[model samples]
Target: VNKEHGAWKCHRCGESGSFPELQRIFGDEPEAAQKEAAARWLVFSNALKVCQDTLLDYPHILKYLRHKRRLDADTIGKYRLGYMDEDFIKQMRAKGYNMNDLREAGLIAEEGNRPTFQGRVIVPYLNRDNIITLRGKKIGGNILQARGVSLGLFGADNVRTHEGDVYICEGEFDTMYLDQLGYPAAGVPGADTFKEEWATWFEGARRIFIVLDADEAGMKGAEKIQGILGNRARIVELPVPEEEDSTDVQEYFIRDGYSLEDFDRLIESYRGTRLFTVEDALVEREELKKAEGLRLGWKDFDHWIHPGILPGQVMVVLAKTGVGKTAWITQVLHNLSEYWIFMDGDHQTQGPGIPILMLSLEQTKAELVERMWRISRLWDPWMTDDHFKLAYRNLRLNDENRIPPEDVRVLIHEFVDDVQMMPKLMVLDYLGYWARSFKGRSRYEQVSDSIMELKALAKEFGVAVIVPHQVSRTGRRGERLELDFARDSGVVEETADFALSLWAPHSKEDRAGGDLGYMERADVRIEILKSRHGGLGRETRMLWAPASLALPAAGERGFKDLIVKEYEWLDRGLLYDDIHKRHRGGGV
Candidate 1:
């Protein structure tokens, strides 16, 4: 027995059962309710076997199925479709099953013990070897399903083995037709019968085509499926109008004379031009509120750019050479790597801290490793009192040798796939540094292709990518930085979800002068040039601690307190000069 999953199998007899089932069989005698349920299930299975054989005896039932329902012999046999008539109750009694057992299995009425599915076609809902329930449908009439049984998604078991494209239709016949046409499909009992939790069944599917009935109820049901499955779902409307009846998938092909190719073309060409209602916007707003994404731990900056950097967003950090762009990015990376859990007393186990993958294209692997170590050293005082190890254990640095020049994007994808833990945040040292490696007609084309590739990777992997960009030589000498300053990349403003430029007020010449001993500790101004979430032209400052290359935000609560309250003796000279100077209001 597997204790974790509570499943056991007998090697000798080839018998397998759940732990609960084993307990009921051997551990203890079953209760009255359990015994009745077990008896009903056995009766139901026996009745299904008899009904299946009985189907062959009835010529009229077969004629109705073939001529009216358009179902062939093979389709009927594959689904185990059967027939039940007035003779059903007499057959059960001759087999030694009583009226009470038939009533318990929902095959007959409680009052007179009359067959409930008399003169109807039987459709059994099977879960592997056992039948979950049974439904009976009168030709061109209503459907009567088994009582007190959960009728889940039809053909739900088919998805466990199937992959790639899947179709979700409104009825079982529609699903069967699609399956016969070589498409993996499942069906709900009705147009609006799909449950939101069932979306997990299709998670492995490449795409889900929701071919619900083409009506108001069907359209609403399709939209609900799309919302639950996100962008992977596509609602395929039939060619017929909503006002008309029989506008389902089966009718579209059979009655409307549409071929498989025509149906394929219809789905492929469907652009879904349906306008969003106010309810859609409100639903999106609530989802955004729930997934506020990763933060940089700067309260002042986080306030202006609320909800942090969301998933699938590409944020570009830009600065001139020798400026503190990498330092700023390192600090953000360290902040994200630290364990952060919800503090509301509801979900306080751990925070949004996630694994990160760093591609050090601008510097060698050794240099990037040293940089991460130095930042952790400065920040470790706040994380722990341990002297030997660092706290940022989730950072993964890629080897520069294994990554090819032209196949940078492809290699990055492979790297992500090879890792055990997928990184939610990926850091690429700089874009322009590797953009020249990609083959293109011109430099501009290469840079643009590289930018698009990064954006695509972020979207495909659902990771927030941060890429630093170099400033043009001419733009470096300008008074202030702009979006166009990103060297060779004109699409950075348009492609990036957020674009930030970093520069210090003091010139490089000023840092060279002997008077500016505290030049390394200068406040580097970070300006948001573009933000898709709408915080454009906003500015924030980070105090650059040159000793450790840690860019802590100015006036932020934690970092400075950690430095002064705990690590003051460690960096006596630098801490006293920088922290005291800031406390005295001498610096910005």
Candidate 2:
């Protein structure tokens, strides 16, 4: 072994070892060289010590330090910040570092972008070895300006040397911000990207805390990192306080001036475990099961819709335009209202029976109220006074400015809890109207996620959720009544426990006037194409009363009697021949 090689000092552990001993531990020449290079980059010298000390005193300096020059004592002490002026670059160049090396090291840039990082506070991005590989410049004010190339493993390089859990952030400033609070942390250069190698590097950590920006992109980045680190990572999703556009960790430290205790609480609340097995999902299911009890008011529907939305069930109702899908839901709500009154002995005191949450995206409260009034006039004409009370207290989705899924859930839960009742049913009118977060993904993915989330809410809260979906334009005109015509057929069909499709038959003039002049009648057909707990392909029809927005009672006829009448009409050739023919062809 060479004598010079025998005195090699490990930059990482600060241990001295012979070349032969290094070779035995780290393999041969090339590996040893790489290890030595990595070790050299990992040194925690006085420069790093100064950086850490500065950061501990002035964390707020990080926000403005990115691309601005403004500095204060708080920023200076908390962030361990240093300004990289023209002289610093001159000294670095005189030390034999080339412009190309500086550029590759993310320090300098060409003209147009010519090193605008000047007069800015520099936060170094270090790798796991603690060697500074990148630096982020913070400019104090809001004036838009270019900063130097960002480098570093985020919090990994700085925090890895510590023994406890490590907090990872998106920017060097964020790392410094956490460090000021006396937490070990690091930051990556960009908020959106994470190097795959960092995943393995962080595997040794007992737990990894991720503090990302509070925007959509930041959330996505956190999700990606969580996917990479699996169970070892915990996310800290800090929302920006009011009137702020940026909610980065560094920004939070600067604006809110949080205590370490506050941060600990934030971390504790946001800390989530990775779900790796089916067993981890049971807790949600059990909670849903507990929430599945009815609030006791929808006697009419309970009699019709047997087994009556046992906890964790999802029901989908589909219909063509002007076919009274909303009316059907309104009827169900009315039944629930009656049930509540019966349970409490007074409509005013009755809790929102079964916590009915109506997300009527397509209609305003006025329109829904009008329809409710029509139902009341037709079904329970004596209860006009009570109908107003029912209409007033029930939840409405259109009242909010932003209709996110979380908002929908919160509103539903609040109403249910307020009434001291469980939500028995949730009706989402016209599914296509709700805003979806995953905008760029495939339609299948979007629909699947939406439906699944709705199902999860139902399962979690033990309520029956009914979603109204429009029919797709792809199927044959007559067969459009089939469940397969429902929008995003594959996912909707799979997710729903019960799928009901509604269509109106052609009028007497339609058959005689040929297909072109055929007038649509108020006759309605309901095809139960799929049912998880009951029989399938069952068809029922009723003379739909548009004014009342309901199916007329078949004069003492049962549901089975109505089905028999529809079949008898089809057999007598009184119904539309084309629709009847297609129904026979499709074996409906």
Candidate 3:
């Protein structure tokens, strides 16, 4: 701690300042301070050649690098790709990189001295020549999940030097894939994060193409980037739900009957940035009124939910198992599809509305059709049993039967051939579907990317995307449900424009004997967790029908509602006044 001019100097990171000032820059936290020092850490990757030679020993890694990711030795050498093992750690330690330094460089675990990304292909995050950070793509087991620098997004420096449309993806492999194809690409650390300042790097670019995961967070993050870039961003929706991530672009490229030209054609079809002018803003306000937003068809939900759902919005329905999450979303989809179909439910009168695409990855199309048919007989007052039977067999149900995903992805090419191409609402049965299509990253990224892609599809088609999800057990443990209970709750809260969390809100004894009385309780415990442009924090109690497995309408109580009779016990207890005071105090 040598002092120069009455100030301490950090010789390692080259900082001259007061102790407090230095501390502010480096921080009191060990990891923070180490990272601060490592920010400007300049060192070339020494393990490159040796790591590449060792790659031959791990034939699996070699095959993954060459065949799976389609990366060559030249690209590997250019990026200075390396491997980190016990020996490599020892060599680094011998070379004077202490555990702190290794941790700072993302070479060792933050909590331990062990090699953080050992037994995996290491991709260095280079700032010009010096490696600033490192990420490890696991060779097997769950190959999609990778360990990256805890802080900082990847691919910022690489894309900054390029010209023309820069493809923004969520994975380093995706960035690598694009660069291998002679395209400029950058990657965020995760779907939820994008270095805000990095948006400025493309100030002179032709356009910014965001090819993030096809899930909620990725799409929301892309929207955020679009806000930053304004009209310079052209968002591309992934054609195959399975291959939605940009990293999967390689697999799509190598697929039969596909090439760079074919891929470019898809890009060309989705090419354009959207911006709003003063006139467009005024027109959009009018459009919102005319459209009246997307609705769940239940009066109470519609009453509390102003303007209902909107185009380019994402709504997640989260509940515990047997809470009727799927049933709720299905009924809402039925309500929405009625406006679409280009014909009425009876198939006699012409109905002119956009189509609804139901992506039921969890449920079969036949099962969904059966559910819709039953709901139609009961939910629609105009339809009789005869009408239900005739229309059920005659009319195409679930829209998937009408326009299957296979046809859109490969079987058919002409979108303008029919208006069926654009849907007003797209209902995905569950979030896990994304992994089935693109399991190229971590589970967090997988879920995030799936929601992001769904969000993108919503905006791309001017539709509202609805996805039903199961809340983590934590959400079910409490008397009051919290948004934090959802699995990947952080991403869910951040990405969804609107979210509804449901719980029974009644005790076991009050459950009313069985499925017949599930909703007979005072409150159904449905809370609106978030709303991008509307009401929030308001809880709505809706009519529940276990027979139809539907939350049909708002309870008749209006503003005045009471908890189930069991709450009388709270009032009858000793220290009731004190308990009431505590409750009132907390509420206040």
Candidate 4:
């Protein structure tokens, strides 16, 4: 009998038993056998029994079991799920099963050799041959810890007959709940850890659904399991509530009272995909030899500038103090309203199409509104009511006033959801105020990450972002400013898809004398320092209307004229006129 005992222990419920008890649950096999099939069955039976009782009372437990234990309903029911009460413990003790043995079997909790699961739900696990081995117990109380004893085979006995579909959850109760809903499922003890043997059971199933608790840890576990299953698995994610951790599907079903249809819908809406190894993806990419062409949008400054402020692309407008960067961005916002109107009219009159979000970290809301009103009156004088809805948010003035990361997340989420088409353009008036760590920082590394995060936010929500930056003092005397003049030149250039530098040319007369005595006139130069798409680096002369704060036609050239001139440069290199004449059968 001692030889027959072998080295068998319940890994699922953390249980241990003597050779006789293992034999009674698994079956009397030869002592010399390499694999004790009976011991596996014994462990599986105990786990199944514990799952059924806990899940029947609290169906939400299914969410937990789906990812933890891998047992299905038919197996759960057949094993006769029950809870161990004081009377049951007394009977077991009468049969010579001491507290020490119960603790070892994980049938009871142990506090210095004392049992805790005196009255608790019982789940038994079985082997492939339908023999019971390990048992788990769900004890009631706010403070009592659950127990699991690993005998052999996680859900072996319950998995006697292979099914077309299998569900994987986090806990035993979750597996039982899924089984009750006419699905085959199993559970793991803990979400963070998984046994390698469980992978084999998933290999044979035609379809495998891994349902995890609606929490970060659960999702991570599901991802880990999906990594093991490869393309053979799909994930069924539970809808996480705003509060509380969702460790079990039964909690979602029973406590939240979600129906089977709702559950199915939730499964259909799972957002995660199986991750492939980098090496594997690289190999596949080489084998496919796929080449995707770029899709270019409008290259015109006016057309592209307003919209190209798109989510993934950052637009940095750098200017010296009092150079009108804020005014330029605000004018851009006003022009965007026209685009919104066009989109709204074309798409079923979506009601005042475009929305704009402005984060004026430097200015108060009242001050921003006043400036907006002054500009709005200039752009649309006939407007009696406020047509453009402006949103203003102020950043922290001091370190103590800084907004928490969670609050920022909430603000962004609310802003995105509240608007109809989401905001067409989001403007951050100044970069310095938006950063929490802006004090004593250069324009490069620290600030660059914050700007990149904002760009990510834009890309995530499909909105355009415009950020204003300050120019360095090094370029004040130069005739023309370059990208390097922008503070933290490297980072600003690297992060932005377009870098627009605004400068007001001072009269030579003012430089000749100590002061021009109010006779000097300044011309605003809009320099396209860097255009990631394509554009000449020439200054577009524009007259700034002080009253309107808008840029009207300066000289005889408009934005369109500048674009035509740039395009002419491209054609000059190609004698396109001769080619066109030949194609038309004309003299070259």
Candidate 5:
């Protein structure tokens, strides 16, 4: 007996119970539930022992299995293979096991205990080291499985020992055979009997090899699972050419001459392949017509993203440590909270700003709020502490955010259904710092997948997403260079609509003689590494102000030197480029 309402579970058959309960735990009454005796697990354990003992009584049965099933002694012992005889019922009675308990536990025949598995081998289903259920395979009779126990996965316990790659088979023989060959393998009773929760067992598993029988039922079952598993799973249709060996993997291996190396070739073959062409994915003009964007407040930063950061586009921020990357984003969010635009000769749109959703994977919720509060104080000279708290309430911030690769799609879809309107700005701070399960993904794989998903999310909601990324130390040696600096990834530069690499003067020479303290004048230089819409290689210098959390010095410099406030181009309906060229020539 384990505990009240708690019993030992079968590993293979997945069945275990003690006796009938006159009453269950009722929602209205707790006293009676606590008083109920615990479920008895000893009954199933003794049944298994007795079954093994009874099977030992018939050594001929074991010999038959060794010859016919091609199973070695190790396999038989590992699986706790046994058999039942007619006298096993008397043995149970001698052991004092209640007949009613045996019936409920599915250890004996419901009507009579004339050895329900008479003249057959009994395969004990074990789970967590306890007998969960049993299966009777007769030498020449029909298969008889114990009632009440669900067919738990065979070799389900093996998943904990390995990670990344798993060979999933449909029956115990195939799974055991593959396991003996040094492959990490597991089995389900049938191809279609997979439980969705089983995915948790292979949490960090990257690739799943589905080794089922090569028939219609098997193929259909594999395809059905593919829908649940997505592209991470591949069905291995054993590449057996000979007609006699076309049925299963076990036969192909048992015949000899075939090694694990040859089997790898068949396992590597991909099933359920689907291909798409350009004609299936061409973006239509209607989508372009409805295109909208979010601005980065400052004219210099906004210019890098053109009219502004477009929906479905990604803007990556890469910087060395202490380079004000985070502070820059904080200032941007504060600006959005206050207004959509500013008319200080740089921004002329002028309106209440778009809403923001900041997924602060690196900072605490309070720390991010404090950062935002500091920026709001900089913008409003007379703002009080109460005002800061009120303003912080408007921005949506969640430090507790993560969707494991297994559940990412489903959970995201659930949120999409619940949300009435998506925010205009989404910030996933410091990508590498997120505390998410790898789900069989390497660090590089995790980053690439995240960047791609963020791109899709932005496009779907017409939001501008800013993701902070880390760069290599070499990329920030203070020497200007055009190289891929995104840590552990080319995907960062490839997927982003524009990449901004910020460098603060780590060298003492550049930081000297700066107005705002040495730390404030990071002597930050923002480079436009890759811009899809804007021209590349554009660079600007900026000064970091710690108190205000902004690029104040750089903003002033760019405003004075390059900002074109000439409204004449707009009045005459000429392109800004045309007017800018004429203005540079002193002829506008």
Candidate 6:
């Protein structure tokens, strides 16, 4: 055995090999340790020198770093980024380095006697000035590492020394991108590759942000890391669309046009999983007081809602089958998509319409476009569906394709990230349709889980969600709506910030007069059954014009002749008395 190089020679059998080769041959014998580390250091340094000198010869590798990966020359040279071409083994042999030593250093494969990192970008893990290990990153492929090199964190020494906030990214390129921009960052080989023992590496970090890919695997990894680090780590989610396949930082900042300032703002805005202090609660309360929530463009309805619908709130709308519940909310969505002018003290405050995503399981795209046309034109009796379809060929609404129940939460994140805005509203047509997708589960459990998920999603993205719900048959038949009528579970009423039910005074009379398709006009009353933000049971009336699913606003001229009354505060005592008189002698 040669102690200087950790190499051994058996004269009788004529066998020769390095220490790493021996370790690989006999799996992890900690007792048989290598004392002479200088030999390995010599091989590592020589291999890196050869790889770095030959990097510029590969134009494709340079193009990938400069164009696709958005890396600059300084970044490439600073990190000692290199490329190992197909002839890398030949170059190492030309330098008089032995094949066995190269294989033991992880530059060559022992099986085929070929270069281990053939046609891959070589990234060196450094401890200050000394090289730790070499990682081979195949373009759009899997990662390759040294055979026996046990690396700690990718940039452990850098992170340990960094005094400011540190970002732990999912891959090498993401870390390099942040590092090049003057931010402190480290790389994990993959989503599941972060080790529990590596948590101590961030001891000197002021704050650690786990900015992983916003995918299922990445999220699970983030959860694992949060478990390890406890309150010391905060997960930074990327704004990635569901339709998009990529969710890395490179795609978010380079491809999606997100800037460094945007990234900084996102980091600053995020309030991790920690509980809020009393001071934090007081600050939030004051912020909410000064904020103006989204308005539905209806005079009376907006007044009844007072400050309108705030972000991070879920509002549930309930009605029977043909009570125009969908139509009314469709109008609200349209109103939200247009700019509104309102008086704020002395000067008029005008703001752009809130971007919206309408996820509909009940209506088709064509049907929704038809409703948009109807609301836009105010119940045009002369325009046929075929004619409207032809006239408005380019007409489009902020809508989503039919999404599966499981993908609803993912799609919401995608939509919010794609638009890059907050206070954006998502109108899920109804809650029952989503619950029906979960087979084998009881209706009660399905409904309960669905609403709870929505509440969490609302708070997560800081966006308002409006979900229309169906009332129970008994509740629909009653003279007034109740909170218990929120479909199968009471969770909907309990979780939502506002619970509203739409009612038409003579719905049965209207149905008896003609088929629903032939019905032209109806007087609809919106009953505020439950309000966590304001008073409950406030009533407002609107006139549904001929053939129009939504109610016309008070400013609308066509509905003026219909003489729809204004808002009225409901008197529960008088309402019960009227109901009693109507049901008198028929039933107790």
lDDT of each: 0.70, 0.55, 0.58, 0.53, 0.62, 0.69
Q: Taking the tens digit of each residue's C-alpha lDDT, what string does model 6 give over 405-512?
A: 435555555554565644367788878876665443688888887788778678767778898888876543435677786777477877989888787766655543
Q: Which tens-of-lDDT digit does each residue in 1-588 have in candidate 1?
A: 653222455775434454445666686545975777677778888898888988999999899878766788887887788988788988999889988778777788756866888877888876665776777888888777665455567877666455687889987777777777777888887765576668878878877889998766777667667756877788786877445654988788777879989988887776443479999989967876788577776666776677788878898988887777778777777677653222232212222456788887767777765666666555432322232122455566765632323244334444554655667788887787667656679878877877887887787567888888888854433256888878776777789988888887666666545464352435578888888677788888776665566777777545554433323333354553354334322111
TM-score of each: 0.46, 0.51, 0.45, 0.45, 0.49, 0.53
Question: Which of 1 and 2 is ahead in lDDT?
Answer: 1
Candidate 4 residues 277-382, lDDT tens each? 9998899657434422111121245443432443445677888777677777665554544311112113111122246666666767666555555554433333
Error of 5 at 535 (Å): 2.5
Residue 500 of model 4 has an lDDT of 83
Encode model 3's per-residue lDDT on 209-233: one tens digit a residue: 8887654456666666665676668
Error of 3 at 504 (Å): 34
lDDT of 1 at 498: 89
TM-score, predicted candidate 3 vs. hidden true structure: 0.45
Cα deviation of 273 in candidate 1 (Å)?
14
Task: Report the number of the highest-lDDT candidate.
Answer: 1
Q: Model 5: per-residue lDDT, tens digit, 300-368?
A: 766766767776678888876666668877866765665222223232222245566777777788888
For candidate 5, give the lDDT of residue 14: 35
Name the better of 2 and 6 by TM-score.
6
Per-residue lDDT over 1-588 for candidate 2, one digit per residue giving the tens place of the 0 to 100 score? 223112245665434433434665675656755564444333223333434444444444444444332344564544444544555455555556566544433345544324435545445444443444324354533211122212337556555555568888876656665665677776765565575666766656778888888765676667667756866777676866768765877566656677667777888886655555677578765764555344223343233445456667787888765567777777666555542211122233333444567777777877787766555444333344655565545443353323555455556545654666765677777665552533528776777777877786776566778877777653444443776777777878888888877665653344224343211344556666777545466556555443445454333233233334344454456633332333222110
RMSD of each: 18.5, 14.2, 16.3, 17.3, 17.3, 14.4
Q: How close is candidate 5 to the true structure, as a TM-score?
A: 0.49
Q: Which 10 consecutive residues of model 4 have the lowest summed lDDT?
A: 391-400
The prediction achieving the highest TM-score against the true structure is 6
Off by over 4 Å in 5: 1-228, 231-283, 339-352, 384-394, 401-419, 440-442, 456-463, 475-477, 481-483, 506-522, 556-588
